[model samples]
Target: MHPQIFGVLLLALAPAQVFCIFNRRTWGARTASSPLARFDGPASLVVIHTTNTNPCSIPSMCKSVVRDLQIKNIASNSSDIAYNFLIGCCSGVYEGTGWDYKAPISHNYKDPAIHVALIGKFDESAVPTHMSQSLRALISESQLRNKLKNSFTITEHKSNSSTRKLMVKNFLQGFAEYKEQVNDLLLPEQRAATSTTAKPAVSVPSSKPSSPTTFSTASDRKATFATSTSKPTTAKNQFFYT
Candidate 1:
């Protein structure tokens, strides 16, 4: 092969090789207390979720949040963190149960779906561009690795009957915004359906809103955590969308 042609090919492929993914070790994730089941085949669906907590952007803080979540999951009797991958607000992607494992949040052991949780409460705000880009990159990486199907469909996690009434509207609002933001990343059929379908109208409660919470970016050193004084909202709150 000609040296010049080889150099040109490498330059063309460089961007595709630049994705950053933080592995379990990077975040000091714990071993699952219980045995984890492996996925039988590549996932065909990607379920989006929000942590419903404060967003973390800095690498150190994001790692701490992920570690805490893992510990919380284990304490709740879950084998490991429920989601397959988590996209940090600014810190990039953090691996959860990973590609080959069947996350406990899935409908069943045989369910062909990859669950991805975005760090932070997105119910009332748009997902930050950095986080969305990381998510897109992660999805592309999953497809390249054969862990996710090229034609995978994306959907937001919906709560069950008990919480659905209180949470669905909030989640749908975020999902609508998210869907629009990532439209270009979707498959042709998915994009067509989204464009044709009208987004549902969400009614905002007349009650006084809670005080606004601030999020830290990659440059910020201090972080503010959301307080429990605020009313509970949707996503990854005990229900896993199948």
Candidate 2:
């Protein structure tokens, strides 16, 4: 090739390479670091909910949704890394949602939700099996790790309780749904064979667990934990959200 042409080609390709580096978060990419604020937690499960966003959203735009989730989840004041996993429309795979500051962009061992997308925008009338396949696989893996049953309980995002235990219970319900949705993605035969029959309900203890150090809430948080004693209406309900 001519030297001049080679230089021009490299210049053109440079833009394409930068685009890939920014857009794809699977092999690992990221935008601003704040929205990914949840990476600092010890949580094990990922909850994925597909909003009815404009289907025309390109990959870069879709990442904005991720940033939004991180913002809301943190704004809601839950643990960082709202979910340990994320599955979306890319190739056939799952991507870890939040990241440790150490593993900023790429998903080698640091990320979870490997090789699958749980949701994708498709023709309403006919959906591809890939969506369910990835979804259920991710769920099953989460459940197995938690040692929970396949058909466990799940709460709608709206579910709430006056107490922290109830809040945890509600979160667990979401966890169960995450497990079921992913596990059900298996082939019907596989689902039927692998799926367990008796699933458990929300497993909250009758009383609150031992209280941790408490702090007062700002406008964002409704409840704070200081003293162990609490009544539904008395103690603040400010610690968390849906």
Candidate 3:
């Protein structure tokens, strides 16, 4: 390689190396159940899904759910990755972001729209036993964490599973209501305030505060569904568990 190009490459690597050194000062892992998933708000809705639909391929039933339930804020970059939090039907917490209460473009996301995935097609079918119950628990806790003193809304792609999990307000931790949200994507306690927090600490360029997650492919989505419909046959089953 050319010496000049290699020198520039060395400079590029320096920041990433430094970031690895300092990341322990940032996000802490606080379990998948933190209310810091969305920022403070009188959240309008929590989006719920019943499948991992790769709409571009074999028409997925969840495609309609994504279309109807996903919020089309101009700032979210793409229509994909639209949910504030996605809980797979297998009770796994997959992708999530945002809890912003301020400017949609500049601030972090804090949407109360807790989206859950059925891990398979649910528009015309049934969700797995574990998924159906796990999402109820999460959403129920979310109601209390967000301090929804009054009635709040929980949304799903379909009108089935009429969630009684809202009863979670009666089952919340003693102090979840008192805790304030930090930035909105994660708990303040979970943020890299000190060591010992177990966040998935990935290194990236300094230009971005958070790194981008890779998108699921059509084949991957199909495989996710296939695994859900039958016994585990793919690697995604690991992700679907709590």
Candidate 4:
């Protein structure tokens, strides 16, 4: 093999490295309390969530928030933390379960999805734009690293049946705009599922064939009529013609 050709091939085949945006140590993730296992590449969906009671926007407050959650997760008899990532309004992003990790956090049934959560109560307070964008960037980079299809899903914890308690209040409104940025990354099946359930297309019927109007004069306007005892036919209305 030619040296130039070999060098070119190596460059083309090498996997691109992904960098973390948030400072893990800054957010006080000293170490994993328990052993952490890595998951296989390219998660199908990225689930957004927040703490149940705390909506702390300040970075200082987030240290305790992460600490407390870790302790609680361990107390619950679960290994390490439940989420793959955590975002604070001021803290950027903190490593939770870490990338390529299958968080014990369940979505739909016991299915594990890539999970990212804001540290504060987004339901009451708005999610900072920086926090939102950082989350998007992180997911986008991860998708590239894992060689995932362009299509992926953005969801909320409340969307998960088992983790309703981890709901990030009022986050959907902002999430709408965030989803658009990564819309192209969504898989074909995801788009097909959306189209299948979309509102039925509206159909307008052509005007009915016109009927000529004619009137007959009554007998000197004194014609008497006997009431007929007949049942009227009930026909369902059709709006369009095939």
Give the per-residue lDDT digits (tens) of candidate 4, residues 1-242.
10011100000001121112333444445455555655775565676766664856554576578878877877787676678777766534556666655665632323335777777654434565556545644554455456232355455544222234323334443442223212233344443322222222223222121212111222212322111112112222222211
Where model 4 places Cα greater than 4 Å from the true spot, the runs are 1-35, 107-112, 159-242
- Each model's number of backbone clashes? 0, 19, 21, 9
TM-score of each: 0.60, 0.30, 0.33, 0.54
Candidate 3 local distance difference test against the native: 0.29
Residue-by-residue lDDT tens digits, candidate 1, 65-96: 89999988889989888888887766356778
lDDT of each: 0.54, 0.29, 0.29, 0.46
List runs of model 1 lying over 4 Å from the truth: 1-17, 108-110, 159-242
Which candidate has the top score in lDDT?
1
Please tell me which model should have the higher lDDT, number 3 or number 4.
4
Off by over 4 Å in 2: 1-48, 52-64, 76-78, 91-129, 143-147, 150-242
Residue pairs clashing in model 1 are none
User: Candidate 4: lDDT over CA atoms?
Assistant: 0.46
